[model samples]
Every structure is written in structure tokens, then in C-alpha cells.
Target: RPSRPASRRDDALYRKADFPWYGLDAAYTGPRWLMQAAVAGDGAVEHGSLGHGEEPSVRTEGGADKER
Candidate 1:
């Protein structure tokens, strides 16, 4: 089978905005397993959830919550 093309939404959004921005949502992927692993490793995956609290509290970098 052939691979799908990457979505242009992130690129477009970044270009449209001038400031340095970061995504607070889960990473995009074609496979369900990839998505599951990402969320499992990182608690701040934001899978249909608004998250626990404010920005600083939830804006952790990669799987920090799992450690704690």
C-alpha cells in the first residue's frame, strides 16, 4: 500500500501566526497504534479532554506525568 500525504494544517497555521507557538494537542498520525502510544506515554495528550488545569501546569514536555 501507498503512504498518505501529510496534512498542511499545521504548516498553514504556523505560517499564518507570527509568534512562536506550540500545539497543546495530541500529535497527528495515520495509524491508531501510534496515537495510542503517544497518549499513553504523555498524559498531556489532550485526547478530547480540556486537560487538568492551567497552561503551566499541563504544558509538560513528553511523558512527564507518567513519571509523576
Candidate 2:
């Protein structure tokens, strides 16, 4: 079966930001991806996170949920 052509919008997972993005460190170089970017009111990135290496996994802590 023929598949539909991929569009630029479909391929775009991350939004454009004015700030520079970096990995964990200079020594560690691996697969990198844009996680998220925090944009200020003036349209400037305050801080953001860039994912590298393996994707993180979710793990519950504090021995399950407890009413506080």
C-alpha cells in the first residue's frame, strides 16, 4: 500500500526558540532531542531542557501515594 507523503508540520516536534540549546555536557555526545522550551513574555527563552542519551523512564517513589 502507498503511504501519504510526510509534511513539514508533521515532522516538526519542537517549536522554534531564540535561546541556544545544549546537551548534558561536552564529553557526552549521543542522540539528542528537544524536550521543551520556556518562553518569556518578551518572547525569549528563560530556561529549557534538552534530552540526550536514552529517554528517561517513569518510576514511582515514596512507597506509593499517601494522603498528606
Candidate 3:
């Protein structure tokens, strides 16, 4: 446990932000510094944004909203 205790880490093991210029709500694969994968499970929402910018887009297997 951290010295300050883990609020989210205990809940979902997701680390806090301020780790980088941009980070996500959680740290799964890598550091939460890139645009979110656009999925559920308390993941980051935007890229290079201060929580005020647009969210990252994820392509569905159905190809309804495929990425360019």
C-alpha cells in the first residue's frame, strides 16, 4: 500500500493521473498516457486533454464506427 493509501487502487487497482501530461483513469497495459481504448471498465476518456477535450475513438468489431 502507498503511504497515502489507495482509494482507487483498492477499488479497481487504477492509478491516479498527473503521472504524465495526459493519463487515463486506470493503468492496465501500459502507462495511462495515451488516448483511451474507448472501452468500459473505468478507462481513460481522452488523449492529451485536461479532461475537457474530446474522447478517444475505438472501432467496434462490427465496423460501425471504424477508425481511419
Once fitted onto the true fold, the runs of candidate 2 whose alpha carbons sit more than 4 angstroms away are 1-23, 55-68
Writing each residue's lDDT as its tens digit, candidate 1 over 1-68 gives 00122236433332343333333434433221111111224333323211122224343468546844
Pick by lDDT: which candidate is best?
2
What would the TM-score be for candidate 2 when compared with the true structure?
A: 0.44
lDDT of 2 at 10: 22
Arranged by TM-score with the best first, the candidates are: 2, 1, 3
Separate clash counts for every candidate: 0, 0, 0
Residue pairs that clash (backbone atoms under 3 angstroms), model 2: none
Q: In model 3, which residue pairs have backbone atoms overlapping below 3 Å? A: none
Could you give the C-alpha RMSD of every candidate to the true structure, in order shown? Answer: 15.3, 8.4, 12.4
Residue pairs in steric clash, candidate 1?
Answer: none
Candidate 3 wrongly placed segments (more than 4 Å): 8-18, 21-42, 45-68
Return the top candidate by TM-score: 2
